[model samples]
Target: MISSRGRKIFVAIAGAAVTIVALLCIFPFWMVVIGSLTPENEIYVRGYSLWPQTFSTEAYKLAFEDPGKILRSYLVTVGITGAGTAVSLFIVSMCGYVLQRPDFKSRNFFTMFVFFTVLFNGGLVPWYILMTNYLHLKDNYLALILPMMVNVFYLIIMKNFMRSIPGALIESAKIDGAGEFYIFLRIVLPLAKPALASIGMFIALNYWNDWRNGMLFMQDETMYPLQYYLYRLLSSLDFLKSAAASTIDLGDQVFPSESFKLAMTVVATGPIILLYPFVQKYFVKGITIGAVKG
Candidate 1:
C-alpha cells in the first residue's frame, strides 16, 4: 500500500494537470466573451483582452439588425438539430442493437463495410454530385439533415455499449416470448441511456455546427442555419461595415470586424452552453462505458 506522502504527491500533480487543462479549454472561450463585449476600438488597439477597459454592445446590435434573418436561421438550426439528432440516434441505436446480437449472420461483413467507410471515402466531388444529382437533396431541409443523420463512428460506439449488455437478459426476455423489437425497445434502450445521451449530444453538435450544406445547397436566406448566417456575416466585411453604419453613428461607433468575429463565436456558442448542463450528467458514464471494448 502507498503511504500518505505518496498519495498527497499524486493528488497535487493530478490537480495541477487538471487545472492547466481546464484553463487551456476555458481561456479561449473567455476571450471570445470578453472580446465580444469589448468596444471595437479597444480590440483594434489592444488585441483581444481578458478584461476590457471599455465594454460595448454595438456588435450585438449589428448582429441582430437583421432580426428576421437571425430568427429564421435560429429556427432552421433548431429544427435541423432536433430532427437530425432524433433520427440519427434512433437509426444508430437500432443498428447497434441488431449488430450486437450473437444470432445475427452477415454482421461481420456489414460491420467491416461500415468501418471501411470510416477509413476511406469517395472523393468530395463524387459525394457532392451524388447528393445533388442522384439524390436531389438540394434546396431542401433534407440537404442538411440527411448528410449528418447517420454516423459510422457513433454507430460503432452504440454497438460496443450494447454488446456489453448481459446476454442473460436477452435469453430471459426470449424465454418470456418477447419479440426482438419489444426486447430492444423495452430492455436494451433503457440500459443504453448513457451511450445514447453521449452519441446524441455528438449528433446534435454536428447538426448545429454544420455550415457546409447551407453554403453548398441553400441559396435561400430563409434556409440559412445559424452557423452559415454567421459565416456569411464574417466573410463579407462590407456587410459588417454597412451593418455598423446603420446601427451606430460611424464617428462615435467603430465597425468591429475583429470584435464581430468574436461576437459571432459568442452567439453561436450560447445554445450549446445552455443545453450542456441538461446533458452534463450523462457525459462521464456515457463516455466511460462507450470507451470500454466488448
Candidate 2:
C-alpha cells in the first residue's frame, strides 16, 4: 500500500485533473447561457462574453413571441420520443434475448444480416424514395419515428449483455414451465434494466433531436418537431420574423438572432440535460459490461 504522502499527492493530482476536465466540459455550456442572456448590442460590439455585460430576455421573447407553434412542436417531440423509446426498447430487448438463446439455430445468420445493414446501405436517394413513395411517410409522424427505431450497434450491445447473464436463470424458468414470452417478460425484462435504460436514452435522444426526417418528409407547418422548427429559425432569422410579423406585432423590436440561437440551443437541450444525469450510472455500467462481455 502507498504511504500517507503518496496518497495525498495522488489525491491532489486527481483533483486537479478532474477540475480541468470539468471546466472543459462546462465552459461551453456556460458560454451558451451567458451568450443567450447577453443583450444583442453587447454581442455586436464585443463578440461573446464569458459573462453578459447587459442581461436581457429579448432572445427568449423573440423566440416565444408566437408560443403556440413552439408548444405544438414540444407536444410532437414529446409524443414521438416517449412512444419511440418504449417501442424500440421492447423490440430491441426481444431481439437481444432471442439471439442469446443457446439452442436458437440461425441466430448467426440473423446477426450477420443485422450487422450487414450497418456496413453497407442503399444510397440516400433510394432510401428517400422508399420512405416517401412506397411507405408514404411524407407529412407524417412515422417518417420521424420509424426510420430510427432500431440501431444495429445498440442491439449488438444488448445481445452481449443478455449473453453474459447466467444460463441457469433461463433453465430454471423453463423447468418451471414458463412460456417463452412469459420468461422474457417476467425474467429477462426486469434483469435487463441497465442495458434497457442505456439504449432507451439513446433512442429517446435520437427522436427528440431528429430534424432531417422532418426536413425531408414533412410539409405541414403543424407537423414540425421542436428541433426542425428551431432549425428553420436558425437557418433564416429574417424569414422567421417576416413570417411572424403579420401574426404578432414586433413593434420596434429586432429579432434576437444571435442570442435567439443560443436560447434555442438551451431550450432544445434542456430535457436531455434533466434526463441524462439520472441514467448516467446505468449508461456507463451497461457500456462497460457490454464491452467486456465477450
Candidate 3:
C-alpha cells in the first residue's frame, strides 16, 4: 500500500502539473487580449507581451466603427445558434433513441446509411445547387439553420450515448404503460443530459463560428452572421491597405491589422468562452460517459 506521505507528494506534483497545463492553455488567449490593446507599431517593436508596452484601443475602435452592423450580426448569430442547437438536439436525440431500441429491426440498416454519409458525400457543387436552386435557401435565414440542423457526427455520438441506457429501465417504463415517446422524454432524456448538453454546445459553436454558409448563400448585409461580418470587414481593410500601398507609400503599421485581428478574435470568442463554464460540467461528463460500456 502507498503511504500517506507518498500520496501527499503525488497530489502536490499533480496539482502543480495541472496548474502549469492550465496556464499553458490560457496564455495564448491572454496574449491575444493584451496584444489587441497594444498599438500596432508597439506590437511590431516589442512583440506580444503579457503587459503591453504601449496601450491603445485603436483596434477595438476599428472593430466597432460600425456598431450597428456588429449588433445586427450578433443578433443573427445568436438566433441561428439557439434555433439550430435546439432543433438539432431534438432530432439527434430522438433518432438516437429510436435506433438504439432492440425492437427496431431496421436499426442496423439505418445506422449504416447514416454512417455511409460520413465516409462519402455528393461533393460541394451538388450540395450548393441543392441548397440554392432546389431548396431555394439563398438569402434565407433557413440557409443558416437548416443545413446544420442534423449533423451525422452528433447523431453518432448521441446513438452511442443512448446505447448505454439499460434495456431493463425502458422495459420497466413500458410495463408501467409508458409509450415510446413518453419513455424517451421522461427517462432517456433526463439520463442523457450530459450527452445532450455536450452535443448542444457543439452544435451552437458550429452555428456561431460558421462563415462558409454565409459566404455562399447570403447576399444581404443585414443577414450576415457575426463571424462572416467580421471576416468581410477584415478582408476590406486588408484590400484597402494593399491597394493604397501599391499606389501611394502607406507606412508599415497604417491599418492596425495585427491588433485588429487580435481584437476581432477577442470579440468573436468572448461569448462562447463565457458560455463554456456553465456547460463544462456536463461536457466533461458527456465525454467520459459510456466509455467503458459495451
Q: Candidate 1 — number of clashing residue pairs?
A: 0
Count residue pairs with overlapping backbones in model 2: 0
Single out the weakest 10-residue window by summed lDDT for candidate 2: 239-248
Global Cα lDDT for candidate 1: 0.83
lDDT of 2 by residue, 20-69 (tens): 99999999999998898999888988989898777998777766766676
Which candidate achieves the best TM-score against the true structure? Answer: 2
Give the alpha-carbon lDDT of every model: 0.83, 0.83, 0.83
Instruction: Return whichever of 2 and 3 wins on TM-score.
Output: 2
Candidates' TM-scores? 0.83, 0.86, 0.78
Q: Which runs in model 3 stand beyond 4 Å of their true positions?
A: 1-24, 40-50, 61-66, 238-258, 290-294
Q: Model 2: runs farther than 4 Å from truth?
A: 1-18, 242-250, 292-294
lDDT of 2 at 201: 76
